[model samples]
Target chain A: MVILFPSKPSILACGAVAGPVERKSVFYSFFDSVIEDERWGQKTNEQGHSQMIQEACDILMKKAEINNLDVDFFLSGDLVNQMTPTNFAARELAISFIGLFSACATSISSVIIASLLTELGASELAIAGASSQHNAIERQFRYPIDYGAQKPATSQWTVTAAGYALVGKHNPEYPSIIAGTVGKVVDYGEVSPFHMGGAMAPAAYDTITSHLKKRHQKITDYDLIMTGDLGKIGLKILKAMFAQSGAKQEELDVLRDAGAEFYGDDKAFQAGASGAGCSASVFFSYIEQQLKIGRYKKVLLVATGALLSPMSFQQGETIPCTAHAIEITME
Target chain B: MDPQEYQQLEQQMTPPTPYLKNVLKAFFVGGIICTIGQAITYLYVIFFNFTEQTAGNATVATMVFIAMILTGLGLYRKLGQFAGAGSAVPVTGFGNAVISAAIEGRTEGFVLGVGSNMFKLAGSVILFGVASAFFVALIKLILVSVGVLEW
Candidate 1:
């Protein structure tokens, strides 16, 4: 369902941090920091995952010129079991925490909740976002990090990164959230976990089409309609779906995916980047910067997530996917 | 669209797997691993007074040890990705699986983590290997007992 924020809660500031391997990302310059070590000098990957989240929150607070006590809530999640990394970071930040789990869409989902809080005058300032670490997430979802398992071309590389955005009262100068859509779980009977994009494309299509229909807006009304982590093939499938619905070629041209173009045609990443952090880092950094620079006047950020646990996948269940979207306008 | 129709459309849109290319890569990489094993067997025969039959055990052990080292060094995973089943079908792949699981479980602690998880991936291989071997030997014994096969 689409929720209109009459108050138009603004994203006051954003902070994005990535691991060592993400230095090669096309939008690397947009990131606030890229640590030289994937572990971030932590003893374990989980510790490093927590460190990455803490670093992102710290940077967000620093950018907004606010301390942890000034923030009302800390909303975040990751792919780790029970989201321990985010939980640990929340403990350190000491902000009233509400951990969310919309899978990869947690970035936007958290922001949506924070925006709702801001609209209701319940929160003055809140930290909201998501994160993922490759080693930590991979070991849980698939195989051990050092295990020699052959992945299909449809498989996506889980990135190690964290992104947090500071949401507060609306400011005319910043990108303000006007409307948000909390997506429904859409399952098209896609069984292969390797082909996540195929499973999630229908959910994204459903959410975007319904969001536009509800808001009485056309696809061309926004400067961009970017999906979170639908890799190269997923993006193609999304486009095809739109085409089948009689969307014009030019209208479809505005569609883009953060994961598809993340590594800039590096075949090593296979289909493209995945994980919770993929959308979080790109949205809070690159897309936010683009809005600030007037490169995009209005945009729709739809973060899609495959909601399947390792146990569910092993039990021969199909992947149920969801996509959460927020319409942001720069005035 | 219905799920069945959507699945068909998705299948149409997705690229076909490069089976021929993958098979070629697997063949070459598997051959290279076997060639290395043969070289180790020859070395055992020439310098260690090991016959062809006796050298088999030593070569297998040596290959697994080398794979364990490569896995710890974080290089075997890359090779596995590049070569697909080529790097996996060999005994070295078994070594990589066990060692990798052990290394992965290090974060959880020693007893419950590394020790128990060391066999997480390879346990199936061992179970099936022993079971099949026992069944095959049982069939042979039955045949020999009935004079249907030579002992």
Candidate 2:
């Protein structure tokens, strides 16, 4: 079922922190802060990831003028084992924490959940965020950067970024979150780790189709329909799926992938950016900026994830992917 | 459709890896690695006035050390990606595996983190290496004792 928040919870403030590579992208201006170092002065990449999350949350709190005492809940996730980076970040913050894992799509998932809780009065103020570090994610999902492994054109570089948003009662000044669609893990029996976009495209399409159907709405109803980290291949796959399903050309035009938008013409990011921070950084920074500037009144942010592991890939299991959709609008 | 049919259909839809190209690449890379080892052994023998056997041992040690340093620098993974099994089949790959684990575990601390977790990957390699060595030694000993082989 599409979760309809009639009360329309507002994201009061949001902050994004990105690494040097991400800061070089076109979306850099939207972020609250940018760190030149991916290491963030931490000895280990994993610890650096936790540092990014904490810094992002602290930045959000500072931006929103909200403290740990004011935040009733903190929801977050990252593309790491046990979501350790986010969990560790939560520990540092000392807030009521709920760790989540939906791979790269985690930011949107956290935002949707936080919005739902805030709308239901579960918390007067809630913080939702997601983070991913290039080194940390590379070590876990693929190979180490030191390996100097050649990345295929299909492989998406994980964004070294983190983003956080504060959710509360709807205010005319802020973007109001209206609804969220929790996704189902859909496996089209794709097993290749290289073709993550291909593996995840089906799940994104499934979630988008379901959300549209449930709401009895067209894709064109929103000013922008964003998909999380589909990369070029996944975006192509999604477009093909839409065309096959007989979706109108206008409807397809509304789709804007975070992967493409964040790193347009940046060949450094092979296909595009992936990881939990991909969509999170894009939404909390670029998209939110547009919303505030009265450019996009309605936005559908669909975060996608390929729920697979190195072990699972090694064992020849198919990639089970998912995508969660959250509708944010301006009244 | 049944699960079997679904699997078949999915396989059909999925893109196949270019096995021929990959095999050719692997062969070239592996050959290059072996040639480098041979060169190192020759260099050691000529420069240090060591015998061929000692030079070979020195080459192996040098390669492992170089591999660990490259792994620490985060360059070995890229090599692994490009060369596939070519990089992995060599003794250097074993070194990379061990050092990578140690790097990952270093965050926990020297004893619990580095010491305990360093062997997580290489432990099996060492175990099988010793076991196989023992087995082969036993076989050689038995053959010699039976007068079928001479030491």
Would you list the clashing residue pairs of candidate 1?
Answer: none
Give the Cα error of residue A301 in candidate 2, in Å: 0.4
Report DockQ per prediction, comma-separated. Answer: 0.81, 0.29
lDDT of 1 by residue, A110-182 (tens): 9999999999999999999999999999999999998888888888999999989999999999999999999
How good is the docking of model 2, by CAPRI class? Answer: acceptable
List ranges where model 1 is wrong by over 4 Å.
Answer: B144-150
Q: Model 1, residue A122: what's the lDDT?
A: 95
For model 1 the local lDDT of residue B12 reads: 86
- Highest lDDT model number: 1
Q: Tens-digit lDDT track for model 2 on A286-312?
A: 889899999999999999999999999
